[model samples]
Target: MTDLDYRLEDFLSQVELEICEYLNKQKTKFPNSSKLLKRFTKRKDDWIHVSNHFRELKAKEKLGCKENSKSKEKTKLQDNIIIRNNELAEVVNELCIAKLFVEDITIDSIEYEPIVFKGDKSIDFHLRFIDGQTAYCDVKTIHPDDTGNWEQYQRALKNKLFPSHASFDLQQDSLGGILWHHSFASRTKMLEHVIEFEEKIVQKAINSSRKIMLFCGDGFRLSKDELEDFADFYYTEKYRKDDFMQLMEAYSMEKEAIILLRNIDYIAYFERKPMNLEYKFIPRVHGSASI
Candidate 1:
């Protein structure tokens, strides 16, 4: 719904700072969903696709007037602003993490949206360590979805395993979908990625020197009951503290793996822990995310 209250906003590059400012400017346009979706998509019908349920609601009315069309279009838009804000929210979330990441190692040399070698995998931000080491970084903002998330699963893994899909050739650069997370989805899905990785690719991320970090936008931040429901669904099999601890331990053994869950006003940093370590900060406006 909003952004983490991040200090040092200037840490963002000029372009990124402009992007954030642009989002701020567009907040004035927020109450309008049709125009918001248009800002994101070039196609006229794409706006409807983003808020298709509204169309169904309008259709169900059995009677529609052109005079009310404009009002009706803007009606459901406000309630669904989160959906409209996904892409932009992700970029802002990444900028927040990038600032922290850059300061962590105190590296000044940086590049944004660079292509990685061994494949065409594009990183959100690339950094050259002070020691002259290089790491490919990708930022993710995962949300709670019940649609089986098969769509992202398919897109993330399709090319890695399917060779005949020529477009995948560009994606073959040691890319993997199995996230080493303070996993939001739980073991079944993570295990599926493990199985798929072993079946299609041989590289073990834990064995590599690269650092992988996952940043869950404010979208992933949930209240107690919502978290419980999410856990019930995510850990559909069992909710064992011991199992989760073991998983976190495994993820931590990696060189520079981090899993952060941040909200508009607080951030919960998880390394190897039964629970996340949380800290409060200023609250920024809320928004959305994809992967």
Candidate 2:
């Protein structure tokens, strides 16, 4: 095998080992709970995905040269795995976003956790483009709490208002699963809820002043089959305008929020997958943009 290829495979193996060790330690610490073990088992691809991207960064020398397996702080994924699932996803989003730039010929190099101004404030990534231009990028994952969906879903669960046939373990099930199960309710209500949810997300998203904003979410995961269906539909002009408009309205930015978004150069969404990393950069619009 080529040396570069060997290095990539070696890096992936090292990351996998580190993850196994970490999760095993967690399992030992919480013997009564199999949640950590179960999570790592089921979501093992997530670490692999991050590791692949990280290897790409390392290969391109885009990591600013300080990061290595031994340095926990420099290794963003290692330091981030200590928190909750959403936090873990956020770190994954950052690495995946970095991978996108690393692969892009327009980008020259990348720096993680770059300090752009005074105080302790920092952006998640600093991208130096090939044309001598640079941009500060930050990753934000819209948590279920950001839209009050978690609380509402919990209330629905407590009141036994969720679908009768739905079978879910509260701690083990994802918020996306709950939403999908409850999606059989009134269409109008669902549309309104979606719009309100997007409004809340857009409001929260505007709080960042970085040159680039990358928004991702735990509930926003799409299966490979679903992505295939979307790809087919995307290539065809079969989508109805009214339906598209309704979707846009559901995810549309508020008029006041437009000003905040306009201040940023670009905004993108991380199209999360269980085993893949894909991104969709939203084009700049005059007054309306979808989340």
Candidate 3:
């Protein structure tokens, strides 16, 4: 095998080993009736399958068991599982993105979850380019809500939009809400949310003379079958690239959020696959457009 292939295989092997060790530790923590315990024991060895499996496990855990136990105790345990599982998925995404830059002559190296400043939040990656330039990328998983809660239902009712991706048709209805298309609508909404939420990080990157990047994960909770055809199943196939680019260009000029959008250098998207990163540049302008 090539050096790059070996490196990837080694990295994946190490990750699987770590997961096994963690499960071994959890073996004695819960009772025989614990669903989480059963899940860990039954987890498949496939990398892609395991990723989606954890998410499914999380969803099932949320539905929870009806056993007679203290409410607080069950809530606490469930919360901990959710948080820990999320961390696993986040780390996987970071590592996969890092692999994209491996062997690229332009990038000298990548530091995962680096501490950029003292007493401040850290982005997912810090890339040192060979030409003495640097960039910071923060990876985010973008997925639709599946809680089916009353509040979510209310919001869907008001907005007339929801998320239900089976055949990529917006005609589907679930709980009295029309499914929202990820490529057509969610992409813009996700970008707006990121700008609002990561304002400080973007500002800090700008202040420090560093290029800012947002790596948004578009593939989340996809089934193994869907992942097999991920290239066509992902957001790109649902809409035109030029049309979305035009939409973003227009949205970037809005008066209120122009400052934030102008400073964000790059916004990249991926389908949870190695070497599949796609860049979507957010244009920087001197001034905002008038209302």
Q: At residue 12, give the lDDT of candidate 3.
A: 51
User: Best candidate, TM-score-wise?
Assistant: 3
TM-score of every candidate relative to the true structure: 0.36, 0.38, 0.47
RMSD of each: 16.9, 17.4, 13.4
lDDT of 2 by residue, 13-112 (tens): 5434644344344332223223333443445456455556556655655545554553453367533322334444555455455546555777666666
Answer with 2 or 3, whichever has the higher lDDT.
3
What TM-score number comes out for model 1? 0.36
How do the candidates rank by TM-score, highest first? Answer: 3, 2, 1
lDDT score, candidate 2, position 263: 41
List runs of model 2 lying over 4 Å from the truth.
Answer: 1-83, 116-121, 145-210, 218-261, 275-291
Cα error, candidate 1, residue 263 (Å): 29
Candidate 1 stretches with Cα past 4 Å from truth are 1-82, 116-121, 146-209, 217-241, 244-291
Better of 1 and 2 by TM-score: 2
